[model samples]
Target: MLPYWRLSGFYFCYFALLGGVAPFLSLYFHHLGFSAARIGELVAIPMLMRCFAPVLWGWLGDRSGQRLLIVRLGALLTALTFTGILWRQDYLWLALIMALHSFFWHAVLPQFETITFGHLGEQSARYSRIRLWGSVGFIVTVVVLGLLLDRFSPAIYPQAMLSIMLAIFCCSLLVPPAPVAATRSALPGDGFLRQLWRPGVLVFFFSAGLMQLSHGPYYTFLTLHLEALGYDRVLIGAMWALGVVAEIILFMVMSVILARFSLKQLLIGSFILAALRWLLLGFWADSLVLLALAQVMHAATFGCFHVVAVHFVQRSFAERYQGQGQALYATLSGCGGALGALYSGYSWNALGAGWTFALASVAATLAALLLLRWMPGRAS
Candidate 1:
């Protein structure tokens, strides 16, 4: 049996840190007097590193069969490195800190995903149940910290984030390593490269990359956008938490969703919803009703999308190559997210929020089209 709670505990703490970063980090940079472009650059640094860092770490984890060890190391290094933010306030210094901190931080999750799946074995469909704890963690942090930020200064953000980082390090220690499958006596004739180059696989990755690309604006500046629209920090945080709360509900029912729907159906639906969500945020920022409706789509956009993605990756690769498979997904997501952040920064500054998110909508629409073209007939 899996050490369910231990694994879930790690996710809870890990995403609690994410909750701290995603919604508030830009606000922190803004409070420090950085412009939107600079904030985007700083945020993109970690994501840019994620593009390559995970593959390297995934390689080592697969070869060494020490994924949990890598997870601990990543957690410790990320926590240690992020503390450098306390030492400097300049853009260059912050960028450097982000680079160093992210290099290791990005390495942790993909490998941990591999470990979690390995633990689940044939019961892989239960992943969302284990994963929902992370959403709960996110909701807790985003809401509580949002309320706190309203009362206190945004200066408290760093200390609060550092505390969550410490918790992640502690969680990393609680879970044991996953058991390895015995190697096949004979290797496949097609090999890893051949499998990766397959048409459906390539399309899946390209489509997935576009999906993350569409999230650039949402993740980087949604809080600031809300603030600009006259919303308070508490309300902004509640809005962010609302999205995750919706995600939690989806995660709870994801097993049933998966059992009924094909991965193709879920992926297409997620992209379509993501496109609509971005459009709503772009044009309807002032409408609390529409904003709430858009937030609720997180159930489809992230929750359903991600659950299907995890399953797709697991089914795509051979047992021994699971680390690499997850790593590839992480790398592609990082690439999309990095580009999204970088461009969204420039677009938010030059073109404004509406156009920035409109661009995001376009990207997601393109992804859905790609999925439609390649993933037909429920083969997935």
Candidate 2:
């Protein structure tokens, strides 16, 4: 029997931690009197670690066939290192804590992705069903913490996040080991780098990176932006939840959508929707109807885009190179995200919120045009 619940449980706790951090971490820093730029810089630390750590960790998993050990160790270290945040809330101390904790935290997901795919084997279409639990976790945490933070202080955020990290460690314990992946079509001596160097795969990774670059403003500042506009904390959290809610709905029907739309088609649509969503948020943020509508676009921007990318990576590489392929995906996405966070950090104060999001819109548009030029529309 498949260890469905075990895998789902891990994704739940893991994403619940992410859900808490994304909306509240910057707010927590702001509460400590950090400027928007400082908060952005501090937030980018983990993302930067993500850019470099995965290659080493992914290689170890591929060679050793011990991905679960890495996942468990990563979870434990993430929690232990994160406890340093409570020691000092100063900018330097928080930066250290973010880097230490996130180096391990970021390493956990890519290895686990390889493990989860190995477990599924032939039932790959069911991937979305298990992954949707992650979306559910995101909604639950954001909504509950949205309510909690409204009643308390952002100072309480760290302890709450630590608890989720502990839960991730616990969930990691429940997931059993899966065998290393095996593929029928893998060539006898084709190397990982050779497969990754393909022109089509290069365009796909670059285009995906651009989409994540577009996300920098939204991830870093959307909560702060909403709060400044006088929206209550509960409403702000719900707004975040609203996007994931749409994503959950999409994940449920993703197989059907994929059957109808090519990955290239989905990628282009997602990029276009992302551009429009950022523009809506940037120009009309005060308009609740428009804000809510833009939030709903997360289904395409993240949900459909993510499903397509994961599938693309799984298909493009040979079985032995699967871990490295997933790692490369994370690396490119991380590089884009780190750059996005840095630019938004500097721009949030100097360029203003509207302009920062407009920049995001421009990045998404660039991604769409790039993909159109190179990524063939062949159904994948």
Candidate 3:
């Protein structure tokens, strides 16, 4: 229980940083007078780096049995690199800094998960109880930052974000190193690449990637879109926090939910909800009621889907390759998300919000179909 609380504290800090970035960063870039396409590029740059960085770092953590060291290093680098935003607001320089920051930031979580599961031992089903702290942190940051941004200048956004990153770095330093689980053992001579290509594994990765990709537009443009529709920062922040709050509730009950439903069912349900959620955002942007309802579905779209996917990865891979499995999941999701964000950015300018989100709906529907056809088994 102590370890759970400690890990939860780390999650709380880590995702609080994400909560700062996800809902507000696009608006910050928008305030800087960047065009929609340019803002998309700026936002996507970090995710692009995230696509590959986790694999390298995860491999090192697995090989050297130094998961906590990599997590701390990643957090420290993320804090330092993000400070570059204070010095350079030029699109190119900001993009480079964001990329470097994300490269390290992305590596931290998969290895952290490996550590977390090791600590959980046979109580893995209780992961959500701990993970819910992250959602709580996200909500706290989004709501507080939203209020702060509403009261203060948008120019202060990066400073506020930097403060959170600093705290996260400090928290990382406090985490006790997680010893390797007793299950760590060498794989067959066939290697990770071969294991990665197994039918269900490939399908799962691609499906999860597409699912995350579908979020690109929502994450990259939703704040700006709401602002364009005359919503204030506070309202925008509430909307963002609302989703995470719902996600928190879902995480709190995830073990029971998983017991009743298979991972495939949850994944498919999440994609279906995602498609509807985007369509609602696109067509009903002006309705607070509709927006609120759409936010609630994030429980399904992100929370349930994520837990099920993580469990699936844990069950699918050997203990020795656990970090690699998590890393691969992060890599595919990051790459797909980057592409989706970049594409949505270009389309936001050309097609407008309704059409751009409509496209995301389509992508999510496709992801749902793929999951239904390819991976029908329970996540066990």
lDDT values, one for every candidate: 0.86, 0.87, 0.84
lDDT of 2 by residue, 1-380 (tens): 56999999999999999889876787898899989679878977888899989888888877876888999999999999999988888888999999999989988998888778778887766778889999888878887897798899888999999999999999999998875443434687788888877657898888878888999989878988989898997798678878999999999999888878888899889999999999999889899999999999999999999988888888788777777889989989999998887788789899999999999999999888888888766635
Clash number for model 2? 0
- Tens-place lDDT per residue, model 3, 69-142, is 88888888888988898897998899889888988899889988888887777777888898899888887887
Return the TM-score for candidate 2, rounded to 2 decimals: 0.91
How much is the lDDT of residue 245 in candidate 2? Answer: 90
Would you list the clashing residue pairs of candidate 1? Answer: none
Per-prediction TM-score to the true structure, in the order listed: 0.91, 0.91, 0.89
lDDT of 1 at 94: 93
| Range of the 10 consecutive residues with the lowest summed lDDT in candidate 3 | 177-186
When summed lDDT is taken over every stretch of 10 residues in candidate 2, the lowest stretch is: 177-186
Q: Which candidate model has the greater TM-score, 1 or 3?
A: 1
Model 3 C-alpha RMSD vs. true structure (Å) is 2.6
